[model samples]
Target: MLVAAKGERFCDQKRPGCSQCARKRALCPGYRDMSSQIFRDLTQVTVRKYHAKRSQSAIASSSQNKSPKLVKAKPSLSLENVALNFFIRVYAPSSPSAWLTYLESVLSCTDANSQLSLSAVLAPAIAIFSHEQKRPSLMYIARRYYLTAIADTGLRLTSIQHAVRDSTLMSINLLTLFEARAFQGRSPPTDWTTHIEGAVELIRLRGNDQFKSVLGQALFLDTVNNIRTSCAQRRIALPAPIQDLLQTLLQKDSPPLSYGILEIGVGNVVDNIIGLVAGMQTGAVYCNDYKAVILEGLRLDSQVSELSRQLWSIQSYRVLPTDASGAWRWSGLAHDYDNPQSARLWNLLRMLRLYLNKWICRAYKKAVFEQQQQQKEEKLLEMGQEFQHIPETAASNTVLMAEYILSSVPYFCSLILSLEASSSSALSSTVRWLIWPLSVVAVSPLSPVSMQIHARDCLRKLGEEMGSAQAVEIANMLDNSETLEDWYASHPRMIVDQKAWF
Candidate 1:
């Protein structure tokens, strides 16, 4: 028999290395007998999911039985911990007291450094309020954390005070900034009143140059832009002074930001821009005034380059070097999406630009002829990779789309984990986890309704990923397809095989 030529079989107990498997998985059954099929099973993570956590629990237990870390099982989670986790995810309580009680519960524990305390409540508290979608009190939870930080860490330095306020500011800034970035290319918080308020607060707080300037500087441009923005919104003057300051800043020959002052300034700017664009108000006034300022800023902005340089230096999420043409394609590494604007936007912009470039190159061939030509480049980092040969069928198209969703699943999972304490994000987390298997049903030989049920299940889990239009585009590419045939007819091969067929 030509079994050897057929490649490794999972049915065979001896499996080849992944490199070998990669060369051979297509022709052969995986090496674990039918066990290789485990990877494809979209069933709930189920029993096997707890392998490490269980080990931790056992260690926790063994520590109780034998070790010092658990003299009285100090690491043991308390009822408060449970309640904190519960409140963080479900919001079962109608009042802020419920949330505070949970935080207090964690605080009641012996040492403040308990992993359960931070992991279960505070960290997630940050994530939850960040995406709560309830804006009545944007920094409502931040006030809680501001107090908690003081309680937990004991404020000593002026920077500690600065940190407390800045952390809260960062939370507000990050949420709005990302909202602006993802909703469209609009950047920064542009609301004049808010920017002025924030700047005034910093000034009043006796902030240092490093500490205070971010607030003041962020306001300087944003307030002007916002005032101009409002005028533009109401069809008012372009506000030339604002234009001049923006130009002066853009033109000023400055070195890149040093970590201390630079990050604060740039971060504040980013925060403001983030808040600004989240409003998504489009107009000729913004185009002529604020838009020009931002473009000029970008052209002259060293902060972005600094950020880009810092992002490039991270070893864990390393993507390809900037292409020969200096193109920074998105590498699709939202694995650690702590910096979603940088990670998600980087890939999205790369893809968007690539798509636009393809269209331009085709429609205006002479333009490309006149311009300097650069070779097509790969995405900066892998920008995520494609799955292997999904079964070929009309369903393959659906499977293809689903696999991309599955790939993005980890990113959403990271978000969920960050918000694990927040019932909302937990629900989001659960939804993202639940999405994969349900998606798998459609691609499998299961009945059509099974796929539909799976589709419904997936949409339910999609939470944040499903709510936005762009996410909807990604989702439609995932769950929203009408017929498997339509995807087959219209979907490009790359689109179909992004994950499996890569």
Candidate 2:
């Protein structure tokens, strides 16, 4: 009695036209030729398992849409419990009011399991736990929550309520921040542009009146800042919509500038300088265009320089009187010195100035080369004399920038330590905000090795305090980038992982 023949199996008995044997031109017995009792089972259990999981995945995906409620409650809240607790302790301390507002919103939400709530809870949790604790399971959980949140948002993306939309955006921002921290320096740099572009569209949909609130304005600034940072880092021209938005906001007749918006303006100028530098470097500007680019760069530099001076002037009025004398020294420590924001801002401006000056030197070098090539010795000599001071000035700025960063450490420490228990939120926020600028100075081509080490040390301390993995990642990244920069100096053809300029 022949039981049902087993399915196709490879055979050692070679047959000329055997399908499986044809490729290798090896021995094969026809499927029908093999006796069931003698043949070994050739079942692909592993492949079957793969198909089974895939089907299950598809089913789970469809189920999310069929009953979105299930997706919301799928992740056991217990998994996020520890993460949520950590967020309150570490992250929320920096932005008490904002956290309070967010807390109220979360508590008021009717559907605790909704995509909005899940994301709001899960992202910060994932971020905090991953940075503070190296739990392997947390990464997988984070990925699941992230995907579900993204999918849920996509399913009902259009015509979202304004309040819901705001919450969604906040979650998206958290997710973006999480990604920035999670990927470390190894991950392909997050193109924050995608989020900003979507945010811009959403802002337009939300209308002008929505920005009257403080939170609205803050969100707007964050979005613009992200876009601005991306453009400056990548040396790309600012997208027109964002450019026009900024221009309108920074118009001459607008209200007196806030420090935050002023920072944005400085970024704008930096972006312009970068764009000009990129053009000059790429030979996109010929001799005829060189003068205009040079003039523009110089003009922006002057504006930034003036802004730096003004920042000092304004900050001077806010300084407490010294015990020794009423007058405050411009370059010395002050009585009860705690604020480093001014110094930080000043150093950043100087860093930008140094970079701009370097580019100016390059422009002059190019011009000199062109004049020499054209046999204009008179112009070449004049250019040489004019540009000779530029490099020296740039070098001086580099030293000054490094000094400013190192000097700020005392003030920064004092500021953080002075915070009363009630003020921890502000303290943490202040420290977190400084990371970008610190990273900037850390990787500057001209930063002294000592300064770089100090910067990393400071970042590590801050990261430990804030449970921010990004700080550690950035420290490692800066070190690696510096090494790579040196290597590339000798080996220009080697590829480098160029990240966004802080």
Candidate 3:
């Protein structure tokens, strides 16, 4: 009997090569040491097996003695389960089907088996869930992921291939949202503004073609609106490219689903007003163009008035009557049905009109100054004639609009609070989107004291429920008994300039 050599278990009686040797195309070094083959019997095999078992036992004992600490592996979290819960119970109510689809896509991308899921997308989602669940540990996880996303985005920014992808843009948007949700109003203002600014840069790099897609357009418009807020608050003009894109968007027949034509009209008028103010701040020589500036203001004001009239003419534009307590109520009855959306929209228009009137007053002040400087009595008289159309007391008009904006808060709050989850989600999103505007109204000095208190309490409640620090801060500011105008007067740097429409 031919015996196999040690470590040559594949050797058989084959003369040329063993199976392993043949597979490797190597010369067979077969079992040539056969001297002990005859002597090696069944007893030897049994002894060898016994020794092997004893060695295994000895090694196990030695290992156990050397290291008794055997930590069990921590199990991976079931992110999918949490995400599904978030989708069904929270997100679906607050957003549209499109957002739900986006969330699903992020989940699929982040599957354990796939490499496509990104930290930027994943981080904000985790953070949002963590905030909603009030999970501090999960918040830590979210922060880590958020940092990872930022680093990843930084790397991608250097790579055109990675940076221009839609996912990259979505990541930025999510991160901004994370800041908004996670920080609420506690973090520095730039925490969210930086993300917003980064998104604007990404949009610029992506260009007008990005707007061809529905999601791209939506994201673009959304980011631009945010940028508009940041710039307004900071008293800066939007980058020319962004300003141009906004103009182009406004020219379109339809805006985003959350925005309306009237809203855009209001935004346009506000932008014009803001632009004029910004120009005036820089000491631009507008004497040559004083008439043009006055005419532009008038034209924009007329545009707003016409838009307001259009809203009034809408079949569903009925105004809800005030209750006995003097609180505005949502009259959901037939022919007097309360469309929260229409009410909100109308309130927004009213606010814009008030804002436009204020701008007209400023324009008059500026034009009057310019005329006085030019020593043109005839021009001054002409300007005085044009100014006659404006409210006699612009400050009173300001208060009226601010009061109206606040008066509707009760109805809005009740509508949002009382509606079914799905309906509330829709209205809540609209209300949330209008936070800056609402804040504007809340802080307006002209808002009545009682209405201001109502606005403050309602805003704080909404902020707490929605996890918006901006709302909470606005409420706090109102609670301090300072109107926004007064607050801005004291802290000129914190002026609320409405350059973008809701």
Q: In lDDT terms, which candidate is top?
A: 3
> Where does the lowest 10-residue lDDT sum fall in candidate 3?
491-500
Per-candidate TM-scores read: 0.27, 0.63, 0.65
Worst ten in a row by lDDT for model 2: 491-500
- Per-candidate clashes come to 37, 4, 3
lDDT of 3 by residue, 103-205 (tens): 4443344322221224554465566555454566777666766765665455556656666666677667667666755663232456677776787788778
Better-scoring candidate (lDDT), 2 or 3: 3
Q: Show model 2 residue runs off by greater than 4 Å.
A: 1-63, 66-82, 85-90, 93-103, 106-117, 133-136, 159-164, 190-193, 204-209, 249-261, 277-290, 316-337, 378-388, 413-502
Q: Return the candidate ranking by lDDT, descending.
A: 3, 2, 1
lDDT, each prediction: 0.33, 0.52, 0.55
Off by over 4 Å in 3: 1-76, 83-89, 96-100, 106-117, 184-188, 246-267, 284-296, 326-339, 362-403, 419-476, 479-501
**TM-score (C-alpha) between model 1 and the true structure:** 0.27
Indicate whether candidate 1 or candidate 2 has the larger lDDT. Answer: 2
Q: Which digits, one per residue and each the tens of the lDDT, describe model 1 over residues 1-502?
A: 1243343433333445334335564544333333223223211121123212233433234334443331221222232233234343344232211113233333333431231213223333333444553433424343343333323222211243433343333222222222221221222234322332343333334333322343434423333333333332333443344444444444445522222333334433443343333322456333323323333333323344454445455422433333333211112321334443333333322222222222222223332233334443543112223211111222333334333333343454555456645445334434423343333334333124544454444444454543423223334655545433233222221111111100
lDDT, candidate 2, at 156:
36
| lDDT (Cα) of model 3 | 0.55
Deviation (Å) of 192 in candidate 2: 5.0
